[model samples]
Target chain A: MPIDEALLERMLLRESVSEFLYREADLLDERRYTEWLDMLAEDYQYSVPLRMNVAFGETDAREETRAGREICWFDEGKETMSLRVDQLNTGLHWAEEPVSRISHLVTNIRLDAVELPEVAVSCRFLVYRNRVADETDFLVGRRKDRLRQVGDSWHVVRRELLLDQSVLLAKNLSIFV
Target chain B: MTTVEEPTRTGAPQVRNLVDVKNGEISREIFIDEQIFKNELENLFPRAWLFVGHATQVPEPGDFFSSWMGADPVLLTRDDKGELNVLLNSCRHRGMRVCRYDEGNTLQFTCPYHAWSYSIDGSLVDTPGALHGVPQQKAAYGTNLEREKWGLVRAAQVHNYKGLVFANWDPEAPSFDEYVGDFHWWLDNLADAFDGTEGGTEAFRGVHKWRIRSNWKFVSENFLGDTYHGASTHASVEAVGIGPGGKGKRRHGERQNEGGFSKGRMKTSFRRGHGASDNLAYEIPYPEFEEAELDEYFVAAWEKRKEKLQAEGRLLGGRGPATLFPNMSFAAGFPRTILVAHPISPTETEVWRWYLVDKSAPEKVRDWLRHYYMRYAGPAGMTEQDDMENWDYATEASRGVVARRYPYNYQQGLGQETASDLDGSVHSHHAIAGEVNARAFYRRWAEFVDNLSWPELTELARVDDRATERDAVVTDVAEGVKVLDAVDVVDGPPAQ
Candidate 1:
């Protein structure tokens, strides 16, 4: 009976995490940037490292540019993210001024670790952005996250994304993934 | 009478007709037409001195960084003798790309297809990228294949100007020094550290490269004295300030009391198409940071640089958002960096950005700059993201037949140029708004695309009648903008 209860606990926790990620995606897609910002803890760190093309065996060492050390696409804490949100609201950030229609689909969710109060997660993201007349981009990537429990909800403390691209295909990364 | 020419169509008149400097009009065909794109790749790129990867990228012997010179892929390598080399990446055999990896360390690049090899190792070949081995040499060709002359094609000339490597495919074009001229002042600010050490900077390990659907010229024009766009195009970023001074400050983080952004910033337009947004006279100090350590570090650097440069009798300005004609562009202040807009087609370009930092910077300063540079430029930067939107949409909308008929205007500050102390260059004292740089750039572009002989190009630029004519009528600046007539705005910096 105890073993069965433990398995059920794991299942419930996975569902909760999945629901939190899905709700986060909904907020982003709905352009409720302020609400989405609330989902992040004050100490939240987000990074999107540049992917490199290296020889087969050298990938483990050189494939992804380091987050805090090397030059990456987006590397900063909540303050920078808040500024990015401010830029979006200005109605003059031409890249997102007209408001890009974005669909952030988070799937393949896996609970990597759970030390209580904090949980590590892994997920795949397929973000589709279309704007203006015909500009379209599909950014597919693997993402890792560290979430902290807050009573009934969860707050993202850290996120690291590894886009499966050597050279970014999109013209601008104006939307949050 | 500018009209679009379909690719392969003949007798379309000279490219000079498409670029009318007198009227300050440039036809849209050059940016959207396929044939003109081919002409640019074939004629202009080969002759122009282009910025390749830096020497630090390949510091160790056998290290390589795959780069692009215009449209051609090149392997920037360091040979066994510890010399840098720029070789065509295509294999000598089946023309396969010899190195597909973005960067690595390898003495020889063996063709993945046929296994034919070329070596930069001293024991294997006389020169770097020389053909070292051929699979089945005697079995397949029976001593008929001459490996001596079958090596990967090498760049005709490669010059490492203070660690910023540049290459040209035309051996007769001009020496890098001759080509750069007094524009080296801008290059000096870019390549050197903030403390005025000669070539004391190196590129960061990661490069931010992304594809944008825009003609390459759009990228070049924006940086080449297009200060006019900053207000309207970057209003959002300005409102949200991502500068060293942190939020609510100007994005450039310029000192608080500097008369509103454009006060003394003048446009320096060179006869050879190289251009800078700020002049040597405009010497605005570097930005102020909110963090005290950052302020201390930069202020100390400023003092050191002032002492060193003044002692050397060099003007302490000309830190530019400048373009080194034909495509390389860079900015030296507020997050120093290099950008190369490689032509993919008429309407698509691959933009590569490399950030620079002083080699001697402390860990804190280095980290702060690295973070600042990431947020300030490139496709992902708040300031640059909007630029891509404009560039892409401009290229897309201009493809309509009705839109191509209306030529873009480059008439701002038309025919208003003052002489400079630097040779073969002029200054547009509009301070804030001037298209003189773009006009000069387009004129030089036409000459290169038309494949004018090196002598003709040199002679045309040596004593440019247009600049001279402006000099003659310098006082006739129509808009009543202060035009410093017959003034050497750059004063006189000791030539290197």
Candidate 2:
């Protein structure tokens, strides 16, 4: 078969990107918060919009609360995200004192756009948290991210998530999802 | 004590027996019993003025915000004449919910099931939410269906206290003013701007809502002057320091006075069942922000507020992490917000939280407050996440067969109730660490659940026994000398 150079380069890019995501999931699940934080760029932006049961045609625009102008489950940058990590490290944080067993299942990754040094990705995340004597919660959501290539690694520049819930079924979003 | 069968005997004797407020021992049954839950639904919720939504949520005509009053789904709608109405969301024809969207603007709600439309349009009906159109009225009903009688069941009374909206199902329910009493001061702080401007605040766009497997009362009691839990429950967040002052500062970012954070902190408990954790005398200025712009904004606002409130001879200290009886809880400072615990079952509650901000605040100031609110108050909030863990586990732990035999102790500040300056209210001398508010709250809950008449409830609150005892008792905190000689406050043999 005749080898196509362009197709080969694309396949290699896919492999590296998939590896980067799987590694990120491992870092989070392993409770290596600092390492996970490193994977995020200094200008990293994060948000989880509050889902609403809007009318049919309104879904495309009004289903989720606006990010900057309106309230969201979370709306912050690296500074606040760092504080969350700091809270977890304290061991005094009662919500996660016992250190819940958490598993972040990141899959169905697709590259929506690929620029020179950046790529836009869309994926699904299912975070399973089991803590202290049978307490369990499953957080399922869609996560969209913009990844920036830095040397041999990728840094998450922005992440927007939409949890598949109108009223959050989980008691608390204590663990990172 | 015999537990009566609740089906036919859902009255005062059973409820009164469960709540021993004088002795400060409340049976666990009140928290978990199915009969008590049903009693609350039938007797308490229907008669009490439960919080609906803010006026700003539906400012424009035809705007409707779907909310809940106890078990009933309500639509808070603004009419063409700029009037607000709280209407039952269920359609009269087939009991189908006419409005399913969380919020939207519409001239009328048309039932998906039967096409029976209720016009919110002023031109169609004299009142908004009146039955304006019925599908094939001439053919299907043949003039038998009474459109006048079938208008959505409107709330008997709906009051817009500044921007906070409240609704009552029973006509006999006390007016919102009488029900709130001196507690209105706390609400004034919540509804007004940081600078004491009347009704100068509005809620942010989204409301944080979620379900928790804990009795709704647990949520209520926590906010009802349960300041004792702060040290232990929120220890981690305090250490993390997400407050405006940044790292190593308290969550509230107190400016640091001589006596510390709890310097003059006291529990203000009203016989009307409302409670506030912070006393009016203890004036703690808003936090000193690490960010210069935030500091400048708050300091200027605080100064202006002090000048305004002081000129009016009002106390500059209505900053409350307070609870308006039945379900509404709020705080007016730092992260100003409202929380209402909607009871789902004996062991489940759906909590809705609305954040308030100054309407005239700069974009930067608003954004700062918004971010601060999200990280501090809700289920995803660092400070509040710990609360959920504790509440869920506590409810679970208390549900065991063996656990139900005991009663939860409410004897923290038994007889330390000092006479208050306000009407129908008392302040616990122990202040920072007291269950006085919780005791009064449960006592009022029992009275309401027992189906006490409006006049009877008013009379009982009008003559608070705690205030009358203020004369005789000389409180020795170390000794636990109670107000009543008959009711010993501690576990030891007696207060010798």
Candidate 3:
């Protein structure tokens, strides 16, 4: 069935938001955290919930139930994210001293219109990082982003990352993805 | 010299007596030998109350996490009734891992190969194939299968002291308090430093796990001492102005004298292999917080801790990077707790790093602590990477025929341990550059690995009863418990 004009506009808006996310990923990959932070709303909520199989043959994974109640890999607010970035820039963060070069590949973008007038965009990401004299550490996951339009630019208000591996291989999440 | 006789294959040579450990320096064979490592898994890890994941990890009902004790896979879970359980990860039917993931919240664990299901409490729930063909499916693989017996082999003894959960495989081993000995005070000090205040100590989210190739003992020894290396191998770090400076023959001396350069403090070693070092330096030393105001609670905690130390006839020493025997270590200055447990192989050890923060502190403080922890200790941390590089190189080097033959030296301060009257604490003049802590650690290591029975080991430890008594007093003070007015000189406390 052919979609309506309004529906098409919403889809386009969602796609644009998804594109902005890719740009954000690019900024992070380029170690441009300050630029990436600009894409986030002041009250942004970023979280990477620790994934688990609750029961056999169960699907329709609920984000809140999985993340809020259980363990989360990364649960941070804007202030925390800022602090992390600040630490990275300090040059004394021994963890990031020999900084790992990262490349973030985001793809398979999908958008869902929610009741709150905010678009929920889901995309898969592969963040590859290589530290000095060490093998590459790969982090492959899906990011569910809730983006809202504020003035002329779209801002990411919420993000819930779902990683494929239960045990993270990276020594640390010193870098933002 | 009496020749040590080898025992028959059936009878394991009567494991070395603990009292005999004073024969000069211990040979490096103890760290590298496969047989010794195997015995350790069976004896030490099993008998000792090894630290496991915190209760916070499996807070909710149905939450589960997998951990290991020397190589034994354990599934730590919270049942539907909200009770904590540590069970063997192996499936009872086919011996496959029931829970494969490192951590998760789940109602039941179903084996991937077979459709056999077990509850979060490790009760066998259902077997699809069995019900179809066999009339007595319940009898074969059902709840009647002595759920407790078949569910999962629970750690023989599981106990928690201040949010830290530890498990033991030996039923006869002393209580966790006794096992902890004077070290309990150090743990209490760590908790008290951040706890009892408004928010208490909140375990910052996320755990960093990595592999270091050196013998686990080597890593423990490094944390224990080897402060000598900071000025040399890490000179590049100093060149970049990240670590301590003052290069020359008197580099350590210069740093120690110039308080600005040396920002950390090492503590006197206690009986039962517990000691701590504190780095007043940044937990996540970045320019971001250079001008930021300090938290009142953090400063107060330090003051209170120092006061307590002073009252106990001990100096209000510097910050602590505290270590409890066998595996656990904590950096009180950063309020970071690290537990590195040895796994199956001597060459392979898993490191679990926790960024412990004052729970009462503002969300921003917790955030900073997390960031700092990630920056310094996490897999991505520069110092951690450097340490891993050295560990990997050491492990590789140890495997070589020539390197294996060469004695790995630990003779940095062979005879320079000076006795101090202050709380009977032994002080090394060159604290950073000395091997006193390492030597002390190895001395305790040999005592533990000598394979004496628990009671026998305790008896041998009493040889320096005064040190043990001092340790107990400090521990009491650290734990915030009423200091015992008198010492009861007895073993096992008359069995209840």
Best DockQ among the predictions, by candidate number:
1
| Local accuracy of candidate 1 as per-residue lDDT tens digits, B352-395 | 99999999999999999988887878877888998998899999
Count clashes in each candidate, considering only residues at least 3 apart in sequence or on different chains: 0, 0, 13
Tens digit per residue, CA lDDT, model 2, B83-120: 89999999998899999899988999999998889988
If you superpose only chain B onto the true chain B, what TM-score does each candidate give? 0.94, 0.93, 0.75
Pairs that clash in candidate 1: none
Give one digit per residue, the lDDT tens place, for model 2 in A1-177: 999998888778877888999999899999999989999999999999999988898888778998998999999999889989999998888889799999989888888888959999899999999988877888998999999999998999999998999898888888887
Q: lDDT by residue for model 3 over B304-327, one digit each (tens)?
A: 655655566544333345566677
**What tier of docking accuracy does candidate 1 attain?**
high
Between the candidate structures 2 and 3, which one is better when assessed by TM-score?
Answer: 2
Model 3 DockQ class: incorrect
Candidate 3 chain A: worst-modelled 10 consecutive residues by lDDT: A62-71
- Note the Cα lDDT for every prediction shown: 0.85, 0.84, 0.56
